[model samples]
Target chain A: MKNRNIPKKLQDNLITIGIVVVCYILVMILSATGLLSNLLQGLLVPLCAYIILAVSLNLTVGILGELSLGHAGFMCVGAFTSAFFSKCMENTITFAPVRFFLALLIGGLCAALIGFLIGMPVLRLKGDYLAIVTLAFGEIIKNIMNVLFIGRDSHGFHFSMKDSLSLGLEEGGDVIINGAQGITGTPKDSNFTIGVILIVLTLLIVLNLINSRDGRAIMSIRDNLIASESIGIHITKYKLMAFTISAALAGIAGVLYSHNLNSLMATPKNFGYNMSIMILVFVVLGGIGNIRGSVIAAVILTLLPELLRGLNDYRMLIYSIVLIVMMLYNWAPNMIALRKKAANRFGRKKEVA
Target chain B: MALLEVKNLSISFGGLRAVDDFNVSIEKGQLYGLIGPNGAGKTTVFNLLTGVYQPDEGFIHLDGEDITRLKTIEINQAGIARTFQNIRLFKELSVLDNVKVGLHNKYHYSTVEGLLRLPRYFQMEKKMDERAMELLKVFDLDGEADYLASNLPYGKQRKLEIARALATDPKLLLLDEPAAGMNPNETKELMETIRFVRDHFDMTILLIEHDMKLVAGICEELTVLNFGKILTQGKTSDVLHDPEVITAYLGE
Candidate 1:
């Protein structure tokens, strides 16, 4: 059984990695052959970013069995912090890629720090209360970012609550952030290759955690908190571990996203309840805890609107219809039976082949 | 010294004493039964002992160490493990993974090692898997190791819960209504399993059971409670036959 488990685990991982590599190669080929339009190529980086967000959000929502609606808040933290860092380094650093990597690290760490602080109190609450608290947190973050102002000069980076001009910077100093205006002039260093790498890295961290001992402890807590505690599992420790890691991965995705845009703002529409809900939609519309399902769902949903531009007025309606049908097909009881039968038939055919 | 000792343990909720002044002591390798009527606070006592509820007034010593104020997981780390009144197996996890969760605390690999798939991680995981399989085999559940725990039959689920608890390698095991909802034959098998666990694992066990036959067949000592207070406690036969115990059982 142990030997069988090894190969099975390896095969599952191989399949996931293989899919990612194939998609990466296909995108590269399309770009090289001039077959992929600039508009479609522009969607690639954001698609990868959304895929990472969906997968990380699934870690907390699906595997951890905790309803969190503040994933966009973590991404917002990462995006703004990393954007600010890149803005500061723009004049100093000649190499865009090096600066981008550092920004990703800083972004992920900033988000993780916030996740740890929030998870400590928020995770203690369960069910709907947890969701509400996280939602409030997301709103709070967005509001704070809206009012935030910072500037950098020879006197060093100055922070002010009033506004960007109130930071009282020296001549030739840059206004890194203006209230409601957000950080501008951020290095647009993110490319399809970088996005793909980040996506693979996100998958690696999340999938690996799902298979580890700590991961088991986390799922056990989700299954039954009392039973988990009886076995000496520290509920808070593992919860925070999953939550913080999920936040960090979302942060990495945010770094990818913000760096791709020349100007990024922490507006309500950009990083508030609607964006959070959109990410949750990706997780749920995906198969909840499934990593590969998340990637597929994110890619399909993100590309669908662009691919169906001919029906511009009805694209969202069509997408909504597809979503409903897919949910019913996946979750309806009779459909589950049919899916199982189809799977068995496919397995049998593969065996014969 | 006794392996587990409880003195003046009490807990209340909303001004009602759920478990009042409960006390017991069990030596190593002992099998003690806690039996009572409905709402008699039998499960509450198990909760207090296992740190699910902090006793308002009491001292609980395990292996001669005071563990009265420890948290649930801390108490478990101190070598105390428990099953639930309702089976609380990791329902979506595989039967093998359910047991492996119990072995989680025993693994020494760091999270970084696990994330990187280091040699130490694989080594420890392989060892834990083999041990988990062995534990399943003991419950005759080796064949169902890969099945979801929720899919198991009632009797097998019960066995798996106990198997999971044992994987914690506890010095004192607590079972809250292990025989609840079982047929007479299933109850009888549980009795044998309870005794087998005590002798085979060399651990002290305290169980709450409503099945009188099971209590009589396996338990050497018994504590009977009524309304959160101890009614009678002594050797199983003596307590089970006590006039007050009979009255309590019959509600006469």
Candidate 2:
């Protein structure tokens, strides 16, 4: 791995260093001024949510090789749970930042637990079938929340800005998410700093996992389940592990999403079918099994429709066409030709070395 | 103790009998061969032994313990490892990574260690890498360790598949077709490698090979199967020449 490979090694190291420097510059720009709120609201929040969405979905579509059409459902769980707690705790305690973060983590953990419960039995069904099962799971969760009574009615609590800044588990905060009106008058605490930190931490963890022996086992199972099984892999166990972890990450994203919005809606239709499909499009439109691709794709997709807002409804039609073109490009013989060329170069090196 | 003992084993899909009251035992440290034409229920026997399919009526003893209804992973953890007949390499993974997959059961560190990047994870990971390299060295695949499994020359991919199965440190290695697509020279070399692996691992081997010469040259004992029945059993010389075995297989 060494001795004869210094130049290649240097090139790789420089590329990694370049990425870090770029990320650092971006973070500084976002965090240094009053621009933090704009960054947090406009880009950072959605970026964090999408990264969590893409990475967690990797466990289903990438690791487990199952198609799940209800990832947003898990996000909805994290969002409402975190929102509920954030609302409940406001003004009742001091240093609410720590509690707020804890609430988010708790939301994630709860979502992960639900994922494990759903993944264990339904993972037996794969591909399109698995997707439908997950869709149903999401629907079931949403419906349960839809009819349940958790928070107080609107007439019960009055929320104020000064009181919100002193946010804690207050005896009375506010009840605003009253059937489609949405939770209003919630505190805006999350910033670009937190979003960037989370995105970086997530990338680091996911990259390391992909490079580990266990990660290799997971990827192998994804590629060929039967082949993996014959070699003594516990398919069900690995599938469950991947599914559980993916769900947990999705939960974390949900927390970020709920807190940033400051409103909680337990409505199942909010997450619904399209959200899952959009996330799937993000992962595949980028590249399956490639972390960098997923991240880049998430950022691009999140920004795409927003960037083209001036075009209005026609923008969406053009976006669909672009997507179609991208998928179709995969069919070109030249793309496959390039694949073989890379393969030949590597193969030749094996012979020479 | 015998490596594998299938006593009065039978399985049926509705009414079509897949394996019918088949009984056989493979001894420790012996190279045994199972040879039959297509549809002789040879792969079915493998499935039953490896816990792919549960027998409706039979007892499977590995090292004298009944493993009649164990899950595939439990069976593997109990020291029975196998390679599929069709090449089943993890196509997208690097060659070395593919082999390291078999070492998962042996690596007992917690997932938390990996997530946290603890010092213990580095130690275990290094050890895994070393062992994976060692296996690659044995098969002359160390040079191609980083190449994707699918990118390996076809013959090397097959060998990589076997290396992966061996990574489990099994007491009994079941090879579905260890020499399926080899040139004559490659097949001859494979015979030596088979012998080397058996001796080096100090393990019993049960192989399903279509090539009669390879089976005759390497196997110490042979079981001839026909239409889900044990047609004959003995040394390669005796069994290959048995009147019933020849007629049942060749229609002679």
Candidate 3:
């Protein structure tokens, strides 16, 4: 068979990439035909952002086997840093694409740096303790962003934790970040096409990492810490690597998110523990460690509420039901056995044909 | 010089001395056995030697270098590898990947190379696959390379663990209770595998086993531990026949 030529891991990765590509093509056709709704069109960029968030979180939760509740905190860090960079360089960088691209890099790197710093001490705690600490960190980041104010004038950029007036500016100083209001007038540079490209890049990075030697080391640490150490896999190094990379990817998603909206604020609804839990919901429902599943789940879940707008009150009821069903489908022992048997039967039938 | 040497290795848990003033010397390519009663500190010695537990008062020399204070990964890099008393395979990973993880330090490619799928990544991965498969074939686990480690039958899991340990290319291989849960038929087969490993890999093995038949059948030297101290140490046959050892095991 032609399929036998490619390695199984490669084939799986290609299928994931193919799924994103196919979806993009379908969306493009829909929009070209003018059949796409306004609401759905607006949801596209955020949908891509959520997919990236879900996949990146899977690296920490599913692959590294660490429970982190501060994912949105990293996302918050990325959004603010990248948004701040883009705002400051908006007139200087002139070109929109170049500015957004640099913002993405800044966002990802900033998140990664923060992730490494936090991971140094936080990763030392496992299970519930790690989750709680991350949760606190997320809240702390969001709270800090709330009180923070920054302005620019003749004396370079001024930073203040108090108020905008405290940032003693020279002549005509532009208030870049007003406390609680966040950065405004950010160029709406994010689009559906760029989001899809980022999703593909994220998938490529995650899937390739999972199959590589470093990926093996990370997964081995997850599987058996003692055995991994005994076999010469550095435990702390792999854990931090996975955590930092995961945070960086989340930051990229944050960059996409920040640029999509005119005003990007670190609100509880957007950058709090609730937001982290929502992304985690996508990862868990999609099947932990299953990259393709995360993509599909993010798309379906993001679109579900909008698609079910007519139901109004019953929309969330149906969403919760779907969550339960998906959990059972992915994790329930009996369901798993049934799935295997069904797959085997189908395989045998195909062979017979 | 011996391939592995230890002097006054000891560790205590709270008020309890888990292992006390332990010492051993194993020449290259020799099969050494450690035996003792149920609570005897056999596995603790393996832990100390492998750097799972740093000795409270002693030193370990592997291949003529002091690895006494090295961490577990450093100890493995310094040429000591071990299997757990209970099989500790990467249960979620493929059998091949389990072995590949052991080949981690032996092969090299930057993380960026791995993520970007660079030329070096492909070259090293191909080498890793071949080496991992060769190790699996040694344990006759080549056919099940894609099988999850947890899916393997118990005896094969044991063999896979040994294969994984050997993949690190360690100078000293420590197998803790290799025949703990094996049937006699499987144990007989394992004894042959162990012997083959010693001859083929030129490995120096230190194993803890309750199965006297497997030990007596293959071990060249033996140590008997009782109540955190060595009761006897000598040839396998002589240690097994020692009266004090018999009393420690059977009770007078």
**What TM-score does model 1 achieve against the real structure?**
0.94
True contacts kept of each: 0.73, 0.49, 0.80
**Which candidate leads in lDDT?**
3
**Model 1 chain A weakest lDDT span, ten residues long:** A1-10
Error of 1 at B59 (Å): 1.6
Q: Which 10 consecutive residues of model 2 chain A have the lowest summed lDDT?
A: A1-10
Model 2: per-residue lDDT, tens digit, A285-325?
A: 77776566677788778776666667646754755776676
Task: Give per-residue lDDT, candidate 2, residue A219.
Answer: 83
CA displacement after TM-score superposition, residue B101 of candidate 3 (Å): 0.6
TM-score on alpha carbons, each prediction: 0.94, 0.88, 0.96
Evaluating just chain A, the predictions reach TM-scores of 0.91, 0.78, 0.92
Off by over 4 Å in 2: A1-21, A30-41, A139-149, A153-177, A262-270, A331-353
Tens digit of per-residue lDDT, candidate 3, span B95-126: 88999999999999999998888999989989
Q: Ten-residue segment with the worst summed lDDT in candidate 3 chain A? A: A1-10
| Candidate order by decreasing TM-score | 3, 1, 2
Q: What docking tier does model 1 reach?
A: medium
Enumerate residue pairs that collide in model 2.
A89-A168, A89-A169, A90-A168, A90-A169, A90-A170, A91-A167, A91-A168, A92-A168, A92-A170
Per-prediction DockQ comes to: 0.56, 0.52, 0.60
Candidate 1 per-residue C-alpha lDDT over A1-353 given as tens digits, one digit per residue, 9 for 90 to 100: 12224457668877987899999999899899999988898899889889999999999988998989999999999999999988888878879889998999999999999999999997887668778888998999888989889988888989987887789888999888887888888888999899988888888888888888988999999999888988899999999999999999888888999999878888776698877877887888888777888888889878877887787677557656766887899889999999989998988898899
